[model samples]
Structures are given as structure tokens and as C-alpha cells.
Target chain A: MPILEAKNLTYTYSIGSPFEKTAVDHIDLSIAEGEFVGVIGHTGSGKSTLMQMMNGLLQPTSGQILLDGCDIWDKKTDRRNIRFQVGLVFQYPEYQLFEETVYQDIAFGPKNMKLSEAEIDRRVRETAEAVGLTEEQLKKAPYALSGGQKRRAAIAGVMAMEPRVLILDEPTAGLDPKGRTKILTQLQAFHKRTGCTILLVSHSMEDVARYASKLLVLSQAKVVCYDTPTGVFAQSQSLESMGLALPQITRIFKQLAEKGISFEDEVYTVKYGAELLKTRLEGRNPEC
Target chain B: MLKDITLGQYFPMNSVVHRMDARYKIVITLIYLVMLFWGQQIWSLAAGLIFTATAVFCSKIPPKMIIKSIKPIVPILIFTGLINLLMLDGGDVYWKWWVIRITEEGVQTSVFMIVRICLLIAGTSLLTYTTSPIVLTDAIESLLSPMKKLKMPVHELAMMMTIALRFIPTLIEETSKIMAAQKARGADLESGSIVQRAQALVPILIPLFVSAFRRAEELALAMECRCYHGGEGRTRLRKLQSGLRDYIALAITLLMFAGVIVLNAVLH
Candidate 1:
């Protein structure tokens, strides 16, 4: 069974006003346990709205969100507990940091859960380490840290809750290449270590291709595609029509195929493209 | 959920009211407000009502939007009505109770106050619905330019108002984002006690304040980069010029106010 399921979920903004807009329209999808699902869309395509509904931050206008086979909006359910079970780290979450020390900031979530001090300490330290923040850096204020460090610290604030389903919206946005790689690598490691389901909302097709097991494409408040990375990227033409592009490596391989060069069109990442090219070259030059 | 606030919000539509000079609209609205308060008799109130209804009809703004602008002040309206209904003492008693009296004069005064207040709100809301905030600020600055000779800092005041008006939507959006972020971190803001709820706001408020300051600083720097040094001889992109329609609207407004004053004097 899926860990989280959104059934015919619809959310409208400013309903009954001139600016009324259907941000997410009847989006039906299920996220299984331990799956890294990447949500991609053009700006204003309702990716953020959909993510907010998954964890009960924003209520759906006309549908249900089921977590662990139970409706999250049910009257008997404790909505606050759902937030702990499903953590969401928003885009540029570093701006949400407010505690005097990064260590205290990370503990904010666990403390909100009313956990014991010792347990909060353990979770905070563990999450800080998981996000690659050193003990020295954890003692300083979040604003005192570098941009990448602040981002990691802010992410740790959510991770300390040890949520079963972690959702990150543009986790690596506004980061340098090295910072992006470091944050994504740490997130991947954290997911692996905890075996938690992650929904990564990203604009980079390459990042989604390299990390996400499944891809969900949103266009104009509707789900255009939701499938495995290879399966979704196969519909590159449709994605492009929606103002989204395929990964650069996949586009290069597609161009190569169009030029009569026989190569796999499914190559999405540079590493995979290099491997494919290396194999093809070895096949052509058998002497070397 | 925070998006429901429509205070000072403009509704864009092409109509005579929208096309009129902002200065004229401001002046006419002020005249209408003065008439609403100055008018004491039923004929004056009827005239005020007719003028407001005509303005609303011409603005082309939906009635629902105008009603929404009044929704927030319904409490004040009700309180004023109740006070007037119970407090006034010099007429034939209709109903009497311990510490409470409803007299003919009280009933008449209450009805008059309520109607005047409603007309006041409807007239002012029509002005906002027809005029955008930027244009309204421009009108205010132009009208107050004469005060600049007295060192009133008219340009600075208008600039501040314009910036504040511009940032209301931005700050609201930021506030909602911060609230969502904190809520996602298991911060319970709804079910907590009064103190707990107030405490929960810390996480959201600190972040909101930080971002607001950051945005203000960035805006200041951007303005400086563009060579903005206040409104000293600064020219405008869209000049405010009164046309024939504006004159006609002003004439109608003046005539309504004069008629109301005349009726009030004769009837009273």
C-alpha cells in the first residue's frame, strides 16, 4: 500500500473572487513507502499547492488525502501528528530559521512534539550530523552561517522530527553547484539511512533524473504524467509543450539518434551518457 | 485563508468611474462623506442614498465586493445602532424596561445613524474599487503638494504610503509561507491555549520580520541604484488631467451636496 495517497484532490485559491484559480485540480496519485518521487512543473503549475496538501498544511477543496490508509482530514485524526509524520521543507527554507543557535533551531520540531529533552537533544544532534553540520557550526546562530550551511541547518530542523515521509520543495534552489551537490548528496544519504519516502519538487530535470525513482509532472493545475523517470522522460515532447524541458543529456542523446547515430534515447544523466558512449566506442574500436 | 482580506484592494474594470481623474474621485468622495454626515433629515438621507447608489451603479464593481468591504465593520455598525436605539431619551416611549428604553426618537436616531454609516462605507468603497492604490497615492500627493511649501514632506509621506500599500500583498504572501513552514514542522497553532498559540507565533513572526526587513533593505538599495532621490521635481509617467467627464462628475457631486444641505435646513 502507498504511504500517502491523494484521491481526486482539488484546491482552489481565492474562490468566488475575480482572481479565483484552481491551483490543483483533481490530482490523484499514490506514493508508496520508501519511494523518492520528484514533482516537476512550470512556475504557477500548482506543484507547491499539491505538496502542501499531501501533509495537511493546506486542506483540499474537494477530495481526501489518505496517509497510512486513513483519511488525514477525518474528524478523529490528530492533524498535528500528521505534520510530524510527513515533514515538508519549503524552498529557501533557510529563511525560516529563527532560533538563536542552529542547535536550538534544529530541536524546534522535536520540542514541538513535546518530546523529552534528552530525546530532543539526540534527534537534533543526529539530524545536524546527517545534514553535515559540524558541532561548532551548530552552536552559532543560523544567520551567522554561510548560505549553504544555513540551508542545511534549516533542513535539519525538519529532519529532526524524523518524519516518515519527507517532502522538500526545491531543496537545492539558489545554491552554487558544489552547495547543490552537497545538499542533495546529504539528503540522499539521509533518506537511505532512514528508509524514508521523499518527494523532491525540483525544476532541474537533470537532478530529478539522477535522484528520483519516480517523476510526477504537473501542468496547468493537472497531472500530465506520473511514472518512472525513464517512462516520464520518454514523453519529452509533451513536457516541452508545457514549457518544461528534458534533461540535457537525454536531449543530446535524442539529437544523436535523430542524426542517424544509433544510441539509446533513454540516457538522462551525464554519467549514464558517458557510459553508453564508452561502450559504443569500445564496440567500434575493438583494438583499444 | 489569509487571501480573503480585500481591504484597500482595487477591482479593475473599464467604466466612467474608473476612467475619471483620481483627484476628482477623491474630491467627490470627500464631498459625499461630508453630505452623509451633514444631512439630518429624511430627504437629505434619501438624497445621499440616491447619490451613493448611482455611484455604485456607474462604477461597474460587483455588489459583492462592496459588501465585502463593509463586512469587517459590521460589528461597529451594530454597536452604534444599539447605542442609539437604547440611549436617547426625549420622545414617546414605545417599550420600557429596567435600564433599557426604546423611544420614538431613539428608533428614529438609530435608523438614521445606521443608514448614514452604511452610505458612508458604500461611497468610500466605491472610490477604492474604481481607483488603484498607486493612482490614489498620486492623487493624494498632487492634492497635498501645496503643503510642501510649509515643509510638510508631502512627497515622502506619499512615497511611504505607496510603498506600504505595495508591500501589503507581498507581506501577506510571506506571512502565509512562513506559517506553512512552521506548521509543517509540527508547530500547532490552532488547538493550543492562548499563551501557547501566542508562543507558536514566535516561529512564524521572527522569520516574517527578518524577511520583511531584508526586502525593505533590498528595495531601498534598488531605488538608490535607479537614482531615486525623493520627489524633488520628479516627473510622473501618467499625468493626472481632469477631462469633461471629471467636471461633470464633480458638478453632480457638488449639486448633490448642495441639495442635501438645503433639504436639511428646510426640513429641520
Candidate 2:
């Protein structure tokens, strides 16, 4: 069964008022486990609203979300338990850090799960190591840490819960490029080590193209497409019309293909694009 | 759920009440509050009811929204009404139930008190619904300008109020975000004992306080960057000039107060 599935999901803000808005309208999705999925949309495309519904933070106005083929909104389900199973790191997760020490903050999720003290400690230390927080850093207050370190500490708080599926909404927002890459790489390593399903909501096409195995596109509160990164990149024309774009390297590759230099595969990442260009150049050198 | 509050929420409509100078609206509201409480007779209180109903109509705000503004204060209204109903000793008793006796005067006073409270709330809410906060701030500063000669920090106080009013929605949004984040981590905010629920609020309050301080610091730095130095020689984009509409509004408020006074004198 898919780890998370939304069946005709819908959310309307301020119903029956003049300012009523349908933030997420009739979205249906089935996401398999252990795959890093990227959700992309422009501002007000319902990305954040959908993420909140995934973990039972919000009850659907109509329809339902199924986690492990069980209706999450069912009366028999404990919504709090579903939260532990599917952790969500909101945008600006660092602002959610409030504990005096980084270690205590990282242990918050495990503590809430009613785990024993020793187990909570072990999970906190393990996730801290995974997120690249040192022992010295963990001993200090969260506010005392640098911006990147504080963010790492906050992410570790969710990681310590060992959730089967983790959803992060714009995790790398408001960070320098180096900080962004460090956080993403650590998240990648955590996924590899734990085999946890990750759904990353981001506006940056390049980051998602590089990290996500599957890409889900939302436009104007509706799903436009859900496909592999390469397949989605191939629909660049339609995506652009939706106020989204292909990654820079993929756009460059598309331009080259239009100029009669065809690539066998859709080029998305810079690494793969370099290899494709090198092979094409080497093959055409003798003819030139 | 917090966003449903219509109290102090401005409704943007191009009606005559909305176009009236905000200073005039403020004075009218103060007078409205005074008139709501000054009279003891039911007929005098009817004047306040008629005035509030008329103001609500002229503002073009929906009746449903006006009802929403009164929702939050219902508990207080009920408490006061009950105190008046059971506690007052009167000559004629209607019903008696073990220590709680409903007297004729009790019913009369309870109804009168409830109506007064409702009119008081509805009258002030109409002012907020019609006047935007920034304009309200400007009106307050202009009204308090006389205190500037006495070395009072009138400008600073008004600036503080403007900032506070501006940040209320932002802070509420931030609070809801923090609460949701904590809930996603299995923090059970609902269905706990009284103490446990209060404990759950710690996570929310700490983060809210931290973010509020950060925002304050950033605002201070930004204000400094723009060469902000107190309120001296500061001109406003929206000048509070009393126009023909304002004077007309003032006349209507004066007439309402006069009507209430005449009703009290004749009826009481």
C-alpha cells in the first residue's frame, strides 16, 4: 500500500464568507514508500495546505487521507499517533525551537512519543549525529548556535521520532546556498540510512531535480502532473505555463535539442548533463 | 478559529461611515459609549439601540459580521445578567428556587444591563469596522497632540499602539503556526487536564515570545536605517482633516445623545 494517499482531498478557508478561498481543491495522490518525492508549486498553489493534511493536522473538508491504506480521519484512528508516524517540519523550522538546550529540543519528539529516557537520549544523539550536530553544539542553547546549526538541531528533533514518512515544507528557505546544500545533503544521508519516505516541498526546481526520485506538480490548487524527474522535465512547455520552470541545466539541454543536438535521455541535473555533452562532443569530433 | 473574530476587524467598504474622518468617528464612539451607560430608563436605552442599529446600517457591514463581533462577549454578558437576576433584592418576586429568587425588578434590570452591554460592544465595534487601524492611530495622535506641550510621550505612545495593532494579526498567525508545528510532533494540545493543557502551552508561548522579540529587533533596525528619530516634525500620509461628512456625523451623534437625555428625563 502507498504510505500516504489522498482521495479527492479538498480544503476551503473561510467557508460561507466573502473571502472564502479553496486552497486545495479535489487533489488525489498515491505516494509509494521509501521514495523521495518533491512537491513543487508557485505561491498559493496549495503545497503547504496539502502537507498539513497529510499528517492529520487538518481534517479534509470532504474526502479523506489514507495512511497505510487506513483512513486517517476515521473515528478509530488516533490523530496524535498518526502525527508521530508522519513528521512534518514546517517552513522556518528553526523558529519552532524553544528548549534551553539543543539536546532537549532534539529529544522533544521522542519524549512526546512516551519513549523511555534512555531510548530518547539514544535517538536524540543518533539523529544529532546524522544531522551533523556535534556534542559541544548539542550542549549549548539553541539560540546560541549559528543559523545553520539551529536549523540542523530543529530537523534533528523531527528525525529523532523515526517517523516512517517525513514531510518538510521549504526546509531550506532563507538560507545561504552553502547552508541549503548542507541541510539537503544531511537529509539525503538520513533517508539513505533509515530508508524513510521524504516529501520535500520546495520552489527551487534545481534542488528537487537533483534529490527527488519523483516530482509532483501542483498549479492553481490542482494537480498538473506526477512523474519521474525526467518525465516532468520533458513537459517543460506546460510547466512554464503553470508558472514553473525546468531546472537551468535541463532548459539549456532543451535549447540544445531544439538546435538539432539530440540527447538520448532528458537532462535534469548538472552532473548528468555534463556526461551527455562530453559523449556527444567526443562522438562528433572526428566528423567535424 | 481565531480568525473568525470580527471584533476590531476592519471591513473595507466605500460607505459614508467609512469615509467620515476617523477623529470624528473616535469622538462619536466615545460619546456613543457614554450615552449607552448614562441613562437608567429603558426608553433612554432604546435611543442607544436605535443609534447603534442606524450606525450598523450606514456602515454597510453585514449583520452577520456585527453578530460575530458580539459572540466573544456573550459569556460576560450572561454572567452579569445572572448576577443581576439572582442577587438583586426586590419587592415583587416572580420565581424562587432554593437561594435563587427571580424578582420583577431583577428581570427588568437584567434585560436592561444586557442591552446596555450589547450596545456598548456593538457601538465600539462599528467604529473599528468602519475605521482602519492606521487611520485610528493618526486620529489618536492628533487628538493627543495637546499633551505634547506637557512633555508627555504622546507620539511614542501612538507609535507603540500602531505597532501593536499592526503586529496583532501577524502574532496570531505566528502563534497558530507554532501550535501546528508542535502538534505535528505529537504534542497533544487538546483533551488534557487543566494543568497539562497549560503545560502544553509552554512550547507555543516560548516560540511566540522569541519570534516576537526577533521581529521587534528587526523593526527597530529597519526604522533606524530609514532615519527614524522619534515623532518630531513627522508628517503623515493620511492627514486627519474634518470634512463636511465628519461634521454631519458629529451632528447626528449630538442629536442621538440629546434624544437619549430627553428620553431619560421624561421616562425616569
Candidate 3:
């Protein structure tokens, strides 16, 4: 069974008001257990809005979201419980840091869960380590931390919840290349260790291509395509029409293909590209 | 769901009211308020209501927007009306119940009080709704310029007011963002006891205050970089000028006040 399924989800903002807008319109999607899903969309394409609905942060103006085959929006469903099960980290989450100390901020989720003090402490420490935050850093005030540290601290706060599925919206936004790599690598490691389903909403095709197995393309508040990363990248022209670009590796391969150099396989990652080049070179001049 | 707040919200329009000099508009609104309170009878309220309605119609602002602006004050208006109705005991008593009495004078006083409160809110909202906050601040600075002789920091006060008004919406948007972010991390704001609910606010308020201060510091630096120094020798991009339409508007307000006086005298 799918870990999460959203059937005909529709979310209209400012309903019954003059400012009424269909932010997320009739989106049908499902994420299987332990699947890394990449959601790509331009700004205002309702990717964020859709993520909010998945965890009951927002009620669908109309439709159903099922978690573990149970309707997440059932009248008796505890929305708060759903939040723990489906953790969501919004873009620029550092701005949401409130607790005086980074430790307290990371413990916020567990505290809300009403877990024992010892358990909260253990989770906080583990999560801190996962995000590469030191004990000294955890003791310091969140506001006193550097921007990248603050972002990591915020992510740790969510990770401390040990959610079944982690949904991050533009997790590496506004970070330096090093910061971005650290965050993405940490997330990748986290997924590998926990086997948790990850729903990453990102604008950068390269990042999504590197991390996610499947891609869901959103346009004008609807899901335009949901397929494997390679399958989605193959439709580069369609993605381009919506102001989206193919992953850098995919683009380079496409350029090579356009130059009449047909590789047997599509290259997505640097490793794949390197292997393909080595094979082609060996075929031409079998010296080594 | 948190985006419906309308406090200090300025609608963008290019009507006559939008184009009128903000300083002149402020002066005219003050004069109209004085006229509203000057009359001592029911006809004065009638006249005030009439003038207010006319201003609303001429401003080209939707009536629903004005109603929304006055919605917050509705509770106060009702409270005042109820207090006047229940407490006042004069003239002939029409009905008497257990420890309660309804008098003719009470009925009249309640209506008058409600009308006064409604008119006051409706008339003031006209000024705010039609005027952009920046223009309103400029007008306030100009109006308070006379007090500069007494060493009052009129420009500074105006500057503060403008910034406050400008940031009200921005802060509200920030607050909503923070709330949603915390909620994502399993911070349950709803479905809690009073104590739990209040405790839940910590996650929201702390971040909000942090961002607010950060914004304030950045704004200060930006202002300093732009050589902002207490409105000294500052030139305006738009100067206030009163034309024929303004004179006509002033005349109409005066005439309405005179009509109220005449009606009061005739009724007596």
C-alpha cells in the first residue's frame, strides 16, 4: 500500500471572498513507502500548498488525503498526530526558530508529543548529531547562530520528531553551495539510514535529480506529470514550456546526443556520465 | 486561512478621493468630525449620517469595504447602545419589570448613542480607506508642522506612525508564515486547553518578535544609508494643493452643518 495517497485534492484560498483563488486544483497523487519523491514547480504552482495539505497543516477545500490507507481528514482523525507521522519543513525555516536555545527548539516537536523528558533529550541529541549540530551549538541561542546553522537547527527540530515521511519545501533555499551540499547530503544520509519516504519540493532540477527517485511536476496548481526522474527529464521540452529546466547532467547528455554522439544509456549523475565517457573512449582507442 | 486581516489596509484606486490632497482631506475630515459633534439633537445625527453616506458614495469605495472596516467597532457600538438603554432613567417610564424599567427617554438616548458611534466609525473609515498610509503620514506631518515651534518632534512622530502602519500588514504576513511553519513541526495550536493554547503561542511569538526586531534593525540601517535625518530640508514628491473641488467640498460640509442646526431649531 502507498504510504500516502491524495485523491482529487483541491484547495481554494479565500473561498467565498473576492480574492478567492484556486491554489491547488484537483491533484491526484500517491507516494509509495520509502520512495523519495521530488515535487518540482515554479513559484505559485501550488507545490507548497499541496505539501501543507498532505500533513493536515491545511484542510483540502475539497477531497481526501489518506495515510496508511486511513483517511487523514476523517472527523475523528487527530491532525496533530498526522503532523508527527508526516513531518514538513518549510522553506527558509530558520525564520521560524523561536526557542532561546537550539536544544529547546529541536525538542519542541517531541515536547508537543508529550514524550518523557529523557526521550525528548535523547531524540534532540540524535537529531542534532544527524544535522551535524554540536552540543555547544545546541546550548547557544538559536537567534545568535549563523544563518546556515539556524537552518540546520530548524531541520533538526523536525527530524527529532522521527517522522515516517519527511516533506521538505526548498530545504536548501538561500544557502551557499557548501551549505546546500551539506544539507542535501545530510538529508540523503538520513533517508538512507531511516528508509523513510521523502517528499522534497524543490525548484532546482539538479538537486532533485541528484536526490529523488521519482519526480512530480506541478503546473498551475495541478500535477502535470508523475514519473521516474529519468522519465521526467526525457520530457525536457514540456518542462521548459513551464519555465523549468532539465538537470545539468541530463542537459549535458542531451547536448552530446545533439552532436551525433549517441550514448547507449541516459546519464543523470556525474558517476554515470564518467562511466559512459570511459566506455566510449575505450571503444575508440582500446589502449588501457 | 490567516490572510483575511484588513487593518490599515489601503485599497488602490485612482478616484477623486484617492487624488485629493491628503493634507486637505485630513483637514476636511477633522472639520466634518467637529460638525458631527456640534449638533445637540437627533436631526444633527441624521445630518451627520447623511454627510457621511454622501462622502462614502462620492469616494467610490465599495460600501462592503467600509462595513468591513467598521465591523471591529460593532461590539463597542452595541455595548454603548445597551448601556444607554439600560442605565438611563428619566422622563416617562413606558414599562417596568423586576428591577428593570424602560423609559421613553432611554429609548431616544440609546438610538442617539448608537447613531453617534456608528457615524463616528463610518466617517473616520472614509478618511483611512480612501487615503494611502504614506500620504496620510505626510498629511499628518504637514498638519502637525505648526507644533514644531514648541520643539515637538512632529516629523519624527509622523515617521514612526508611517512605519508602524506600513509594517502592520508585513508583520501579520510574517506571523502567519511562522505559525504555519511551527504547525508543520507538530506544534498544535488548536484542540488544546486554555493553558496549552497559551503555551502553544510561545513557538509563534518568539520567532515573530525575533523577525520583527531583525526587520526593524534592517529598516533603520536602510534609512541611515539613504541619509534619512528627521525630515529636515526634505523635499516632497507630491505637494498638497487645494483647488475648486476642495472649496466646493468644504462648502458642502459647512452647508450640511448649517442644515443640521436649522433642523434642530425647527424640531424644537
Task: Kindly list the per-residue Cα lDDT of model 1 for residues A130-162, writing each as its tens digit.
Answer: 888999998998889999999999999999999
Tell me the tens digit of each residue's lDDT in model 2 across A1-288: 788999999999888988999999999999999999999999999999999999999888998899999999999999999999999999999999989999999988999999999999899989999989999999899999999888888988998999999999999999999999999999999899999999999999999999999999999899998999988987888999998988999889888989998878888889998998888788785856
Off by over 4 Å in 1: A14-20, A258-261, A279-288, B36-43, B61-115, B255-268
So what's the TM-score on candidate 3?
0.90
Model 1, residue A208: what's the lDDT?
A: 91
Winner by TM-score:
3
Best by DockQ: 3
Candidate 1 residue A101 C-alpha distance from true site, Å: 1.1
Q: Which stretches of candidate 3 lie over 4 Å from their true place?
A: A286-288, B9-15, B41-46, B62-114, B255-268
Off by over 4 Å in 2: A282-288, B31-56, B61-122, B251-268
Q: Assess each prediction's global lDDT (C-alpha) against the native.
A: 0.91, 0.91, 0.88
The positional error of residue B22 in candidate 1, measured at the CA in angstroms, is 1.9
Interface quality of candidate 3 as DockQ: 0.77
List clashing residue pairs in candidate 2.
none
CAPRI quality of model 1: medium
Tens-digit per-residue lDDT, B1-268, candidate 1 = 7876765778999999999999999999899889888988888889888888788888888888878778978999899999999889877999988988899999999999989888888888898888999999999999999999999999999999999999998999899889889889987878768998899899999999999999999999999999999999799989999999999989988998888888877877
Every model's DockQ: 0.73, 0.75, 0.77
